[model samples]
Target: MPELPEVEVVRAGLAPAVTGATVISAEVRDPRALKRHLPLGADGLPGDDGLGGHGVRLPFEAGVARAADFERRVTGLVLDAPRRRGKFMWIPVERGAGDESQPGSVPIPLVERGARDESKPDQLALLAHLGMSGQMLLRAHDAPDDRHVRIRLWIEHPAHGELRLDFADQRLFGSLALDRLLPAPDGIDLIPGQALHIARDPLDPAFDDAGFLLALRRRGVGVKKLLLDQTLVSGVGNIYADEALWRARIHPETPGTAIGPRKARELLSALRDVFTQALAEGGTSFDAQYVNVNGQAGYFAHSLNAYGRQGAPCPRCGRPIVRESFMNRGSHFCPKCQQLR
Candidate 1:
């Protein structure tokens, strides 16, 4: 359940550790960890590279080399960078698919940071959305279980040499996206919704404004559901959504379309405010469940406006914060402030 800010923290934790290293080994660990990846035994090894006709790319050759290239070429490598676009991360593929016939999902290719773009087949991009309960981390293999570790990466570099990275989640609902990451036919292109189809971005300082209003202009979905939709805005999860709505003095059950611009803008501003505040509060821990990649429970839960604070008093109005089930999701709101008119 790690959202944008939490994910950004993970990315920051990794830059120093694995950014410049070669991926000596990459293991999925849990087959269900990856959506498109075929099931595997305990270690979650890649199944016969779907392209048996052609030889398979060895782990280190393809993996480590690729990781090095990614650090070299790709700028702004961060957890916030690889985000969900309607349930998947849109990674830019360097080349075309490996097989082309039964093209497996490899969004970002190994040669991302390298200067090798002779043909499409030579490189490719991968899109992976760490499903729920799926967490990602970067640390020395000796690093103790700071949190739930799912995937592990053994990275080697000439400068830093080596380290083991881990991605873990207890519920295991997190996912990863691997689009045919390589860029497509020049002039030939993917449909509009192919990449992250973000609606309103409260985070973007220069984020689109009119576009955000338009998305909220007409939609019968409840506010909670609307905010949860990555298409509407990438990265807002249950925690931030609840907090933002509560801050806007809006009820979670209020229908999206019924909201006016004033309410929407307040809600938007609250989104940024809540994320900033939550990142400060340790990002809302569910239980002993979602500790950071470092295995520390998020400090954000203490500052929560609505989530996990059932029957708690609303800080702003002193009214009791209410919790109810909607769309089968438990939502928290303040009755006095967020009236359902």
Candidate 2:
């Protein structure tokens, strides 16, 4: 699965290309997942250019020359830009990182209301969540369809003009949403600079030391399982959870509620370091699916401390990193380094 870092890369790559353009057309091979993403009644989409009408609006030569090519292509899924919520990628009304109200709290302007007129709307946010096996790629305007392309879009850009695109998902768990309503999860903040819901990034200044200790000490679940809870902290996926716990020198199964405040800081710091490093590597890829926007493997895999390095040597104590099952998922850690409390 593409994590926050990998998806951010894709979004960064796509932002300039998709923003300001109207959806020329959109085609969904998997309508079931598409419905989950962009519910019909919600209608958060841009002014529909009726997929067929776009062809006529194009230059005579451009339209006719591409008639055969555009025949079956879904008209327009104009991407006005996209946003992310923990793991859920969405399109909001404005462009840029958007106005940050406070940490984990950003106003998501959706739905045409008195607040935002439909005629002068800045852009309709194209929210997407690339689940475990999903990705969005920018291809040539007339690029041939690849084998994994489940969702396709023909976007008109400012500089590049018309560019055909694909949102490929092997697992079909990822989704797309044309939201008219920016539904926020209860209790989770969306401020751009402040903490995200599930993610208390190590880099943030508000990395609640006291709160961290309290959160962990309150939960009896294994540290690994507790890390996976988005409600507790946003964006700490399985890979990150495993890595952070390993770095903290605590077994993945050590109950979070049992860890002390001093150790809690270590755990939190390690989480920040792991995610910050992985984001720079463009996110990790142990499986065949997770490649960056440029289709390159991440650099973090070569330096993994314990997530997938099961039987491999622990980078720290030179002992073997052990792997086992916890919470129905694989748990890896350095046995010698992480003593049981």
Candidate 3:
């Protein structure tokens, strides 16, 4: 799966090209990619609260109908700057060309539900999650369809002319949806309904460092597992978790309660350093699927020290690195350098 840095790269690439662009048409070749499009309510907003629980559920009807509905609503909406949280990315949508009530009206910003007045209209955003093998590629206006392209958006930008954004997913696990915008739990800013549950990443300026350290000292779960928890801290996946632990010289299986405040802070700093380095290298790409919008591979795989170096010598100590089975995945570490203490 593409992690935080990979998603951030895509968001950055999309910001300039798609900002202020109007969607001329939306083609859904495979309706499966529209799985995340939630049904709307009588008030023209999402059927339920932004939380994942207790919402209007998707039905068992033919997916083509759902795809049609998605296209109908998404067409003619203007895109604002692309935003991201954890591995999720979305574009703030504005009513533009296709709206019948106010054709050619200037685009209005999406207001948070908490602050929105009754007289104002509801707002929506285009949410995207790159499950396993998904790719959002930017191709020419008339370029041939890429393999497994589930959805295509033919958009017109005021400065860039016609452009095509293709959502290609080989495994059919990723999705595109038009979700309502709601105020974040902390009242920080508005976010897509589907992404409301994700916690702030370490790179976020609003991330609470002291709160994280306090929480880390109280959790009874293994330190690595706690780090991977999206609610506890967003964006640190298996690869970065292992590398951060190795840098902090903490065993993956060590309980969070066993780590002191100094050690916990060290782990957090290590995570930030790892993510920064990965972003600079364009993210850790090991295959063709995980690439930037332009289809270029990342070089961070070469700088890894612990994650994929099983049986190789540890860069810190002379001991060999080992791999252990963990939650259906593998955990690699320098056994000699990282102790249970």
Candidate achieving the largest lDDT: 3
Worst 10 residues of 2 by lDDT: 65-74
List where candidate 3 sits over 4 angstroms from the true fold: 41-45, 48-62, 101-116
Assess each prediction's global lDDT (C-alpha) against the native.
0.56, 0.62, 0.83
Assess candidate 3 and give its TM-score to the true structure.
0.90
The candidate, 2 or 3, that scores higher on TM-score is 3
Candidate ranking under TM-score, highest first, comes to 3, 2, 1
Q: Write the per-residue lDDT of candidate 2 for residues 20-41, one digit (tens) a residue.
A: 7655555665543342332222
- Better model by lDDT: candidate 2 vs candidate 3: 3
Q: For candidate 1, what is the TM-score?
A: 0.70
Clash count of each predicted structure: 56, 32, 0
Local error of candidate 1 at 336, Å?
1.0
lDDT of 3 by residue, 1-341 (tens): 58888889889988888999999889988777876876454454444423222233334354655676677777888999999988889999987844755443333333434656867666678999887778888888988777888999999999999999999998876889888777799999988888899889999999989988999999898999999998889988889999999999999999989999999999999999999999999988887878788878888999999998999999988799999998788899988999876
TM-score against truth, every candidate? 0.70, 0.74, 0.90
Model 1, 13-58: lDDT tens digits are 5455543454444555443344343222123222333321113323
